[model samples]
Target: MGDPAAQALCAALRDRDWRAARDVLVTVTDPDDQAFCMYAAGRVPDVQEWIGEWADAEPRSTLPLLVRGTHAVHWAWQARGSASASRTREEQFREFHRRLTFAENLLDEVAGRDADDTTARAFLVTAARGRQVGRDEAHRRFAEVVARHPWHRLAHAQMLQYRCAKWFGSDEEMFDFARTAAAKAPAASGLAHLVASAHLEIWLRLRSGEDNRYLQQAEVRAEVRAAADHSVRHPQHGRYAGWPTPHNMFAMAFAVGGDHAAAAEQFRTIGDQVTELPWAYAGNPVRVFRKWRGKVTDSVA
Candidate 1:
């Protein structure tokens, strides 16, 4: 229903065709692409029921393990629901930790079995967040991912989440991480999304009216534009498989930042594509996407 690979993998899982799913996954070598595939595949319903069988059948291959581990994160979140910790019940918290620990164990096995497995290492960054790993430990896990794949987008994004104000880190830490990564990243890559992500996080953290004010700040607007230049606007930026994410991210950032014209540009590039993230953070995915989309294009609503 989403990415082509995701659809194929989802179909394979529904049909209990692990072999076909493996075939679709094995072709993807890049860390970003692999992570994207995993993200989509992990969201499919009833995966936990059969994913274990795939893991058991392929004792040698880490692909099944990776799939299971990635799905575990989704499973953990589902158990916990989307409510803040204060709102979550004790039972949900316990189950969240239990599932996260399971995910951590599988990811740890993959990384240990193959030291250079950036995909496994990237998912570890995610597991660390739910597990509430120590700051130093989280840094170590993230470092392992970037050491193998310096521009590992999933790893960076996951690490940013762990360091967000809503999580372990504070606002200063979040901006520092985002800006430093964008500065070090090579042009044309989408590292700049980190900056947009940080801004979005901060905006979401504030009170209702304060949230909009934060995004509307002059400095915030300038940085968001600069981030756009570093990514979507860069001439060398080619449309990759997950291209819609960055466009949608920057579109949301600009839309909230009171730059309707810039928002329009990103919205144009995005066209009809709506990624789960960036919008899902605000409200109902499709409704929120179309609201801002209508604001910019006067066509989506």
Candidate 2:
């Protein structure tokens, strides 16, 4: 029931067909896979609700439980008001803490029943961050997951965030994890995308004017190029699960680095699917992606 529509959605997403994207996303079944597609399309609420329905229907399925935790963290992040909001910041923090606590409990419940639920363990990293848990605990959760699924893309991405300096990890630690993860993954497994993800995190943290220079740095550009060659651009790159998400990250990195040609190729690979993250740091990801795509298309034309 879900496969044909999900496949069609994947094909349309590969072509960047935005118009029919939503209609197709409704057909997907796998909780994380469906959430990935929905997130790319900016349908966060829909995915959360759909996952909730799945959880209700199949309370035994740990997949929906894990996705629910991710969704809660997303909401909790939103609840944490910005620095400018002094009036409601306290209230926002309360809501944020509540959400994070809920997500952590959900993950803990998942862990209790299924010790092998790596996805739940991976998501625990995010919930822990939101809850202001210590980095050591977050790392422990991440290690528990990666030890099981060494090449788990979602787990690696979550771990990358936990390893970020903003979350108590230093630059050296973040990059080391990125490089190590890439080195350990099988070729064409799309694990190398973590390098580009690390660079994007660094670029986002840099001062406004420093972003361009930071991206163009010898090592930064080298890492990005290596990740591209090893993953999306590899001649034998396979269409692994959640393929377009990494392409979106790579595309954004190249576009920001002034490498329109490389960005265009990644855009071509990702088509219309656009996620909230990495792009959200720059502002409305949909608009940013459209602007970059236009620039890439003009450069090619």
Candidate 3:
């Protein structure tokens, strides 16, 4: 959610001003922010009831259903069982499927009412992927969303996850999508981070220290550099709704590729901000970040 929107929504909710909150929500133009607000609002029963009442008042509005679906899928993904209980995993998967089914149905309803609802289409991609829907169905839903909003960061990221080998997609397929998506995105749009995301996925799949060798490959090095220059070094580069993570991904890639100077620049840009992703794959995110940040910072010193 946009910081301003989040703040306004929080204040309205605190003041029990449902009408004001609804007004604030209806004006949110960013699909990702809209979905996030719905997810956050879904946490409160009273807020949900207010949302349901709003939906009743405006049956044609897809916002309520879209929020509900996004919230359900977000909740379902967190249903992972405890590590010690094997049966719990099975139970969790069953419950996950049930919740996903409900979410998918809600999204489908929204689609039926408004085929052009980009947010709904994006959630459909997520819902289908989570339900283990076939690659073809997953791709179809993703295509529907990206076809309408080519620069959608969240949609692209979700599709990247869908195409990951761990999710029944091969590395070749994942890289193909990542490259194509990156190429289609404008340089300043920061969508080129899709390639960094793909590289991270490929690295995580390798055993032990092999990822270092993989990152050193000629082709990988070339692609990573091109993406970095376009999205991270471009004069037009600026902050987006999703910033720092992309810069952090590039920083990790450059560090692994042994370009300490380039890596150091990225770290300087990132400053104290850090994301668990890509780094988390290595170990404790904070420790991993410190290791790389130290590696480059020390070189300059």
Candidate 4:
């Protein structure tokens, strides 16, 4: 039977009242629901506590614990300046390893299965492992998954495009690829953002280099504006919202088009709302721009 407390918590969350959700979730007797609720409420400390309680009560339920534990670890890392953060980080890492071992055992139990569940599990494992190791390897594994199941092609393509954007030097080639990918996967807002980002990057590069291609600048700005507008209207499903990429892109386009005051206002808006770790973008354009902004400004000056 479903826990009544959990049901209440779900109802509260649906109403967007996190405080009520947290209170109800903490009262729930079910470990799974407790862990999920704590995560939804962004209550990292409570999540860690629930993970420990759940792990001891049911050792086999490791995957959910691990997912919650990862969130705890991420939060703990952000709390690095706190006195207890180091110990919390170490504890979370140990739990992560335990969860990984359990996941491996679970996979072994269903080895050779051709079921969709197995494929999904494999895909998640690959993506998680990729984050832990190298982006290139992660993209390679994602590509394999898509090849086996074309239904996942759009997601894999977005990941690959992110990898290319972060590590590759050839802007024209990357932009071409992004344009094609975006056209092929019209439903994927992430790919659409990448397409817009590629154009923005080209514009940034040209402006820094004093390339007087004003016609090209106008075209790139229009393309980026359209993509950003589209992404704002149709964000990718299951992706984190409120990213400042589109805002930053619009600001950049305005700045390049001699709208300094508008650009400054946009930048201020982004700077005000940009949290330290709101979401993870493997090949985030805003991060890249921030890292190189000083150098670009100096060169242009």
Candidate 5:
């Protein structure tokens, strides 16, 4: 079955056995299996042959191409050496936007027949964009989707992450929602880590001033550090690996903690990495630095 083959490929990827996974994926005729295979190929180094083969064979399919597009974005983001890294960053951004738009359109096509899946996938596509623009809009859409399908863990997790960063409501409300979402997510997949990291970012911001009450919450600080450490130890644990959020969050934390130099260094490490496919930079280094610089200046002034 496609699920088993997909699982096997995921396992192979986890074990770093690209060759075997590629071979295993080659025999799968199912669309989902093929998509997962393409996803795996995109992760491996020097697999142009595999990527080309899959891309050429399934250029129109949203799932496989989405995987390829994300990988391409990762490559582009990583290749960006500096802020003035020329037109490539812009090009990659356009490409990711195109893919995300295509995925959104595809969701419409399947909506009538499989509304739940359509909503779930659409949530993923839009949540990726939540990092760029439309934070509030994305949150609204994700909330609607999750309301319709409460079991969609990814969408719920993403909604929580977006809210944490956007600070949708009071600190108490955001903290409560974030803690609940982290508790609900499966531990192995690292959704918990993702949500917790977002919480940590907010916590760091709230604690920027000595008078902040949440600064004394040892549990929050401990959770944030733990999430960051977990993410660092397993970068590829989630759907979108090499995304700049974790790195940017780490930098933001350091910046807020009065370590401007450390924050700058963290941002610099991600300066070269291309933005993730879907081009979610709602929390990218450029934006993060812009915000951090403002905060620093405000603190000094």
Candidate 6:
């Protein structure tokens, strides 16, 4: 979503040019953009090798710590892989916990020094999930972020993941949270994507035909249309670095739900900018994207 700034930062981090990365990161002023940027950059490989230099270089600044801590969360998950707990090995789980703990410490340091560090606070919500820190702890970390920046798209997204049935909450809990948050966010804010995300999450959990059936339900499809109007489809929707993600999510939601007309509209808006999520939950991201897109377009044609 916030891939542009993250790509620049990733390039700098890859080159081990902390100064260049810092220069690029400082240009982004919005706290949620800052959080989104760091979260995306966290996927860069071997950042742990040289990020400490940035930390040492700017002992007082939380940016380095933010980068390092966010990277650790990604690093932790990489160690764990995307498999279910039963599919994951004991060693992988151990390393996942260790890296998550390391990330938590660094994030905690940032939160300590900068109470307003939403980037740090947001990642802690992620860390809570990795560590399986239970609902209360996850909520506390989420509370920390919204208390500072209410309707923070980044924080809300992470918190929504934490509350998902796959994590700690039930399907009911997840839907309630998504509906409430989407309603609470400004009409133009990308936060309404949470509804799409929740729908996509439930779809992922259901098996095969059941998944498609759930999405195609009249009430479910209706809810998504309302959310789309409230956010991405809204005339006032602000196109930002993360704009494509919601479009992609809704596109998949519609195509799978048999609303080819709606799906075709979103695909036109999306073009080639496919996100890894909702699609990845199905099959090869690009393949899945094109498959559904072709089907929807043909149906509409």
Best by TM-score: 6
Query: Which is the leading candidate under lDDT?
Result: 6
Query: Per-residue lDDT tens digits of candidate 3, residues 1-301?
Result: 2356756765675565656776887888776566445545544434433446656766777766766666667666666433334555687888878878877888888888886677778877777666788878888888888777777767788888888887768888888988887787788777788898898787877887898888878888788989988888888888754467789889998888777788899999988878777788888998999999998889877
Q: Is candidate 2 or candidate 5 better by TM-score?
A: 2
Task: Tell me model 3's lDDT, rounded to 2 decimals.
Answer: 0.75
Q: Write the per-residue lDDT of candidate 2 for residues 1-301, one digit (tens) a residue.
A: 1234545654554554433544564455443455354333322443444445556766766645655665666667677854544565678889989988877787788788886666567667667666767867887887887776666666678778877888778889999998997887765678788898889888888899898688877777777988888888888776645677778888988888877788988888777777666688888989988988998889887
TM-score, one value per model? 0.95, 0.77, 0.85, 0.43, 0.42, 0.97
Off-target runs (Cα >4 Å) in candidate 4 are 1-50, 58-63, 72-136, 144-162, 165-177, 187-190, 199-216, 233-301
Identify the runs in model 3 with alpha carbons over 4 angstroms from their true place: 1-3, 6-21, 32-60, 81-88
As for TM-score, the candidate ahead, 4 or 5, is: 4
lDDT of 6 by residue, 7-47 (tens): 89888988999999999988987887787788778878899
Predictions in order: lDDT:
0.86, 0.71, 0.75, 0.45, 0.47, 0.88
TM-score of 3: 0.85
> Which digits, one per residue and each the tens of the lDDT, describe model 4 over residues 224-300?
55654455435452232223544554555545555444445555556644322211221364464464343334434
| Candidate 5 structure quality by residue, lDDT tens digits, 85-167 | 25456665565556455444444444433444423243443335423546566655665555654434445445554555343
Candidates sorted by lDDT, best first: 6, 1, 3, 2, 5, 4
The residue-level lDDT of candidate 5 at 154 comes to: 44
Clashing pairs in 2: 16-272, 40-274
Error of 4 at 46 (Å): 8.5
